[model samples]
Target: MSEYDKVRVGRLVLKGEKLKTKKRKHKKQGRDEEGTTVRDEDASAHGGWWKTVRIEEITGSIGIEFGNQTYVKALDNGLFTLGAPHSEGEGPAPEEILTAIKVNDTKIALKSGYGKYLRVGPDGVVTGRSDAVGAMEQWEPVFQDGKLALLGCNGCFMSVAQDDDSVVAVSKTAGKDEIMQIRSSTARENENVKELPAEEQGSLAQVEENYVRKFQKFQDKKLRINTQSRSGLQKAREEGNLHEILLDRRSKMKSDRYCK
Candidate 1:
C-alpha cells in the first residue's frame, strides 16, 4: 500500500462528550491491490487510529488548539503495544489507577483505573494508549475517537515533534541541542557567501585602522601650521615689523633674512 493509503490525516477531538474528526474527505478511490475498503477499521488495522487525525510533521511538531485549550506531543513514537508489563507502585497508584506500562521493555508511563486511557475507536478496539509523559512536563496526549493528540505544557524549550512509520517519543528532550547546533554550524556557511575569502572579513577592521592613522597624520600637520602662525604673529608684534612684513608681500619684495 502507498504510504498515505488508509491514512486518516489530522486531529480528532471530544466536544461535550462527542468525538469529532477534524478532516473532511479530500478524495475517494476504489480499493488497492488488497480488498481493503476505506472503512475506519481498515486504518485502525494498520496501526493507525480510525477516528483520530494523522498529522505528519514536515519541519516541527504539529500543534492543535481547541476552545482555548491546546494539546501537543511528539507524533513520531506512538503507543506500540498493549497488555505490556507496567511499573508497580510508581504512579498515583490509587486502587483506581495503573502505575505504568512497559514500552520496549522499559516501564515508562501508562494510564490506570477503568483503563479509560486504553482508548478505542469505531471498532471498539484500543488503537493507542494515553499516559502521563515524563520530562515532557505539561505535554500530554488526548485520545478521542481513534486518534491521539498532544496537549499543552508550561515550560518547554524548542520542543521537537516528528512522525515516522513507527515509534514516537514526545518530550522537551526531543530535538534538544539540534536547533543550537544547526544555527551555530550555519554561521560558517553564511560567511562563505561573501565574494572574498574568510580571511578577508578581518581585512575590513584593518582598513578602518589605516583610515584612523591617516586622519591622525592630517590633524598633526594642521596643529603644526596653527602653532607656527601664532609664533610668527607674536614675533612680528614684538619687533614692530608687522607692517613691514605686510608691505614686503604687497610690493613683491624678497628678504631671505626674514624667511627664518
Candidate 2:
C-alpha cells in the first residue's frame, strides 16, 4: 500500500486525487492484473473509502528541529515534550518515537520507541514507562470522520487547545479546532522554504552588496559623456536580469584617474 501522511498546521495543503477501481459486471471476468481506474462516481458506488488513515502516534522521530538553546523532542520516550531539552544546543536529548498497538480493550496502546506505552489516567493526564499493561495504559481512538482525535479513559479528548499550556492534556473537548495535524518527516518541496544552494546563496549576497554599493556611487552627471554605461544601465533596468545590473564593462567600478 502507498504510504500516506496527513497535512500539518504550517504546511501547505493540496487537493489529492485517487484512482477508483470499478467493479466488473460479469463474475466470470477476472480482475485486471494492472488494476483499473474509473471516474469518482463509479468508485463511490463500489463502497470505496480508499485506504483508511488514522491519527497514529509514532515511536521515533526521523529528525529534529534545531534551535539555539532549545528543542522539542520525545518521539521514542513514549512521551512527547515541547521545550528546550538542553541549556546549550550541543547535546540533544533522545527523541522517542511512538506506535499505536490496539490491545484487547477498545483502547489502543501508543508504544514508544523504547517499548514503553503512552497512557492517560482519569484526570486526563498522560504518562508512560510501565512494565505491565493496565486499563490506564490504553487510549480509545476517537474519529471525527477523517479528523482523528483520542478519547482517553479519562472521558476527555486529547487536545492542545489554547485553553492549556501544560504539555499534553486530554481535557480538551472534541472540537474540530482541537484536532492536531501531526505531520510526518516525509520530505516535501516547499517553494517558500526553497533556499538557494550554498554557492548560489553566497553569490546572491555578494551580487546584492555589489549592486547597493554601485547604486550608492551612481550619478547622472556623466550621462551624456558615458552613454555606453548609461545605455547598459538602462538595458539592465529594462531586462531586470543579471546584465541589467551587472554591466558587461568589468572596469565600471574603477576610479576615474583620467590617465592620458
- The model with the greatest lDDT is 2
lDDT of 1 at 56: 16
Q: Give stretches of model 1 more than 4 Å off.
A: 1-37, 40-51, 54-111, 114-170, 173-260
Q: Judged by lDDT against the true structure, how good is candidate 1?
A: 0.29
Worst 10 residues of 2 by lDDT: 42-51
Judge candidate 2 against the unseen true structure and give its global Cα lDDT, from 0 to 1: 0.44
**Predictions in order: lDDT:** 0.29, 0.44
Worst 10 residues of 1 by lDDT: 178-187
* Residue 236 local lDDT, model 1: 66
Tell me the number of clashing residue pairs for each predicted model. Answer: 14, 12
Give me candidate 2's TM-score against the actual structure.
0.36
TM-scores for all candidates: the values are: 0.16, 0.36
